[model samples]
Target chain A: MNAPSANTLGANAISAYSISAAVPLETAAQLEETLRHIGATRYHSLHPFHKLLHGGKLNKGQVQAWALNRYYYQSTIPIKDAVVISRFRDRATRVEWRHRIEDHDGDTGAEGGIERWLKLTEGLGLDSAYVESTEGILPATRFAVEAYVHFVRDRTPLEAIASSLTELFAPNLHEERISGMLKHYNFVNPDIMSYFSRRLTQAPRDAGFALDYVKQHASTPAERRAVCNALIFKTNVLWVQLDALYHAYVDGHVPPGAFVPAK
Target chain B: MNAPSANTLGANAISAYSISAAVPLETAAQLEETLRHIGATRYHSLHPFHKLLHGGKLNKGQVQAWALNRYYYQSTIPIKDAVVISRFRDRATRVEWRHRIEDHDGDTGAEGGIERWLKLTEGLGLDSAYVESTEGILPATRFAVEAYVHFVRDRTPLEAIASSLTELFAPNLHEERISGMLKHYNFVNPDIMSYFSRRLTQAPRDAGFALDYVKQHASTPAERRAVCNALIFKTNVLWVQLDALYHAYVDGHVPPGAFVPAK
Candidate 1:
């Protein structure tokens, strides 16, 4: 097998994720390194759209477009996590993962991550109802995000957990976003951005459990490879959403019937 | 209820197709008019991408991107039709729909519509295996096409038949495509473009059966409205695929992991 080329993660390469090269049985440290390498190279943090977003190069309207489309992703996370939990028959695993649903969709009185996401979009001048409706997001956003849900629902249980491994890299991006958006955009404040601040802790704890589960359970090299592939697929899911935002809002080609930010 | 607005079919509207207004009981003729009006406004034939494609304004690479992405939709039709078939308990409907699958998948030793689609892609210089693998098609293509399948699977049987109503408008686009490509691109020949020619007849027959089924079966005003909404939904399905093509190819913002036509 050929060595994983830098081009393996290019936007236009392939649908299903595969390893860059043949798998060989490896130590836990080695497998972890491979997973981290995939993140370093393939994560959505590297996307130009994020750079534009965090760097504050975008206008209020552009930011609105981003938040509006992103709400769809944010809203769907619990559904995806629920699907992941459903894939496992183990009660402990289900109980361990069950809190993720609560993480996004809080208990009776407390607001959850989805509510926090609304604060961000609402702060950006998007209507809360419209954001909740997901009526105005890009078709690509809907497609890519739904694709993630389907991936989790359809793939093996190990792969579903591995797919959430994007969370492993999330704390860093969340860190960058909170500081960068606050520093850069006048519209951004700590309250609207509380989602990230909270995730700084929640993500690492979640990622830690997931990472350990993956490392322990991927018993064979082939399973190890599947774990890595799932991570790469998750990154693609995250990456493509940004690509859609960049294409529609940044490039000024707002597709017909999507949200049109006021001039 | 508000009359159907000009923007009801806009590209970025709410997803699940709903009527512009509540259904008032209507004659069969009124319902048919509503469905026809939807096609005139919302069909992919009206998309700028198609105008460019048929007018030969796109370069060969652009055409290749179109064909490559569209192959995903073409390949999914049989699967979608089968889902439609599965939804039906009526043997007459099943027998009627069974031939649609045969037309696409073909009997032993007979080349099907999918094979003809590969010929077009092959004529455009795309590898047959690559085209068949669908690894390079856009995420939007997969999402939109699969959304159609799910729509069929999840909705009532009448809506499933109504979703195929886009075929009512397909023959005209096929004729325009055949003549336009033959006249404008030397690389396109009658042999390579056989898929459109075949669809010219097949689509009308399929559409007629579907249209009659919808009209005859939709007994109530709400049912009639659903029939119209189903056509609108189908049109949106077609419209978004072209919109994805336009964003990726025409606007030059190809998303990661999709087909990038040769330079």
Candidate 2:
């Protein structure tokens, strides 16, 4: 059923299975299973660009585009988390969410996820100023990241928390990325890979809380469907960034005024 | 200087000229010149995809892709305009801005921009329900349009008004598209191209007010720069939609689950 038949409606087909009928509300384990099924099929790890990236098939310029464009996404995580926090009325829930902002932005003078992301870009020869300014990334990158912030700001709190569940699938991808890049690319090393390493722990803790919150809060069939749709939306955000990178860098059709890796 | 040089940073170079030096503010005419210069160089009309589209170089499927993806952008205009209206405190200003929402959404039974846009899509043999659902659009299209909404929601009212000044460059593109698409493609006709025909009038009226608003309100040098940058941001929003279309359809690398034309 996942194979997109001629009669199926493309990307909409993935959701069609759940949306076609009003099934009975699932138990906690069943809901988790449904969420996991979404991750298994639709995560960005399944994207071709990730294949090229982790397999070391991408050249240095392509890799630079990946890091440079991805910096925008990494930097915006704290902003989106903050927006998510603002939506919560409960102090305990807000306190639980505040850790996400801390993880990305850090306490005074501490290196946060954003700075670690810069280390990866700097390792690949992009200027910290330029990366921090986010002036060189693909337009798709900006749009995708900004959309995530808006989604959290505008969607219901239940949906916002569910969106963060993409992190449940993230750790495995990070592990593969770290080992694959370290094994394959001469330029990639432990320091430059620190962002992924840190995420291996942070993502699981974050995803665990988010998953629990969603499982507990999504009390009805419709609420459960919205939760699933939010995860799908977040995955689209990640997948589109890679699609833009692959289009511009690997395919070598850089839009006028976008970043072009030096020969 | 417009050509991306080997030493120059890619798309970021366009903004470099502005960031490098802070110049004195100008007369109304000079400010208009600067705004038009940004449009001349960065408008989506300048994208190669537009050249392909207006030149009738793209096939029917390609045109369908263009229409389908752009429906997401067109449909969201009222929502973004509503967000813009929410930001204004002045009663007179809100009244003036309210026309934008009406132009898109229309009065009872009056065919507005969104409905007219559907005529274009339906004329191309796409189901109205499928088009309205927007379930098959490129992820980039969603991200780009959503970013524009967020920009309006998040930025100051002055900047939001300036962003709408992109309409200044719209009428001519509409004229070109109407004539070119009509002359070149048999599927295109005055009935189907009513959206463009309508916009030719609507754009100028809207752009005139927005342009005057931006020029009058952006009093300081920094404020003027922000206005110019806002227009540039809006231009990027439009350009990126075309870029996504080109990358996905023209480049033959549609992301998994996006619309794929039947053979």
Candidate 3:
């Protein structure tokens, strides 16, 4: 993690990013555009490694690396979803979000996304206990995952729901991952990619629900701004994970005492 | 701002910093020590620019920068304090915390910390309206400052109070800054330094009351841990500001558009 060579983005980059132009987005569609712009520009979906993974270019170990690292995110989803669930006072909203927990945790063994995620890790030759320990996960990954949990736990219920709108884009990301990895990575099995398959359906419904919730509930201009800002914060949360991964593994200055793959 | 690259703590340096032997400490004292540790390591007191400003090494422009950036933090104090105030159901606790708001916002002209802060800003030749607009502060500074405000708003009351325990450590930092800045920076007049003088007596008293409350109230190990974690998080909240500053000014990649000094 050597001093990342001064500012990673440089001063000009900061100014360019901060020099925000105020375009009045007129519709929820326009609002959606704002959210999407953040994702297109800021989401981990745009990260180069993701491009490599989805384009069918990754090797077995690299795919293993992705699965192993992503496991922390998978495990934390229910916990984070539960935080959102706890915030819900409306019986209907709670009932809907509660299904999300069930979807990830599954009613019984081998049923939910968590179980399917295990299949991916198992396919990658990761020990379930080690994976569950989450000790070996990149600290950056841990930070990003936990940050999402904190977001739900700490934000106003609406803002929490708004932050989860990242899921709206997740379905698209998953489809590309499945197709790209299937076509490219020989070590990956379509069977093992079952987790993304569930996400393909689950993320969209959840994202739609969240997006509609934000659109409808963010009734005031100020509320709309908060919702927009919430999504922006969330995009950063995901992007920071890549920043960590790139810095740690790709950039070769991995923080000391973090997971080091066997040579 | 352009995408911030992976911030490396230098793997080897981070590694060397990680492996300390566990010398068991009193759970209570250990908690206190952990809180103090966060203050020592992450608190804004450690920022080198703080060193330059307080040690009188900075020019008028730098002092202006310090006042400008710091006012963002000071302005939010009452708002954050108010949220914490709202949480206190006990009339006495609420009454006590009420003083914090009064101290920061001022009851009348020539009184209160908020008024004093403005005086300092004016003394530095900043327009009151410009400082109020907060148009010139760094984005990182605003986020970090808001994070503190949000912490008090979102956390449980005991933990919110526990987070304020940084005040116990602050009086000393204030003393250092005041003495050093007074000695080093000619732009810093005694009246501008008056804010620290007031904080010297006030912060310690406020902190003493808070420390007693935390020690007496956070009796269980789990509660103790939460209190300790709040302090740690609070420290990081402050520390990240310094990291942002160093990355910008010191590293020379000053994220494109932070406070640029007058030529």
Best by lDDT: 2
Model 1 Cα lDDT, one tens digit per residue, A1-263: 75443244443322345554443436566578778877877788998899999998999999999988888999899999999989988999999999999999988999999999999998998889888878778777877788888889888999999999988999999999999999999988999999989999999999999999999999887888888888877887787677778877887766656788898
lDDT (Cα, tens digit) per residue for candidate 2, span B124-233:
98998988888788888888888888888888999899889889999999999999999999988899999999899989989999998988888877788788778878
Q: What value does the lDDT take at residue B22 in candidate 1?
A: 36
Write one digit per residue (lDDT tens) for candidate 3, span B1-263: 63211122222212211212232223666556555555555566765656766666666766676678778888888898899989988999998888888888887554888778888989888889977777666555665676777678778899899888889789888888777877776667689778889999999889888887887788776787667667755665565455444434443333223566666
- Winner on TM-score between 1 and 3 is 1
Report the number of the highest-DockQ candidate: 2
lDDT of 3 by residue, A1-263 (tens): 53221133232221212313343334566566566655555556876668767876555655666677788888888898899989988999999888888888888544988889989988877788877766555544655566677778877999889888888778878889888888886667899899988788778888889888888887765676667767766765665455445444554444334566666
Report the C-alpha lDDT of model 1 over B1-263, residue by residue, as the tens digit.
65543244443322334555533437776677767767876678888888998998999999998999889998898999899999978999999999999899888999899989999999999999988878777766777787788789878899889999988999998999999999999889999999999999899999999888888999988888878777776776777688778877888767655677777
**Candidate 2: misplaced stretches above 4 Å?**
A1-25, A108-110, B1-13, B16-24
Fraction of the real A/B interface contacts present in each candidate?
0.23, 0.36, 0.14
Better of 1 and 2 by lDDT: 2
Model 2 clash number = 1
Q: Model 1 in CAPRI terms: which quality? A: acceptable
Higher-scoring candidate on DockQ, 1 or 3: 1
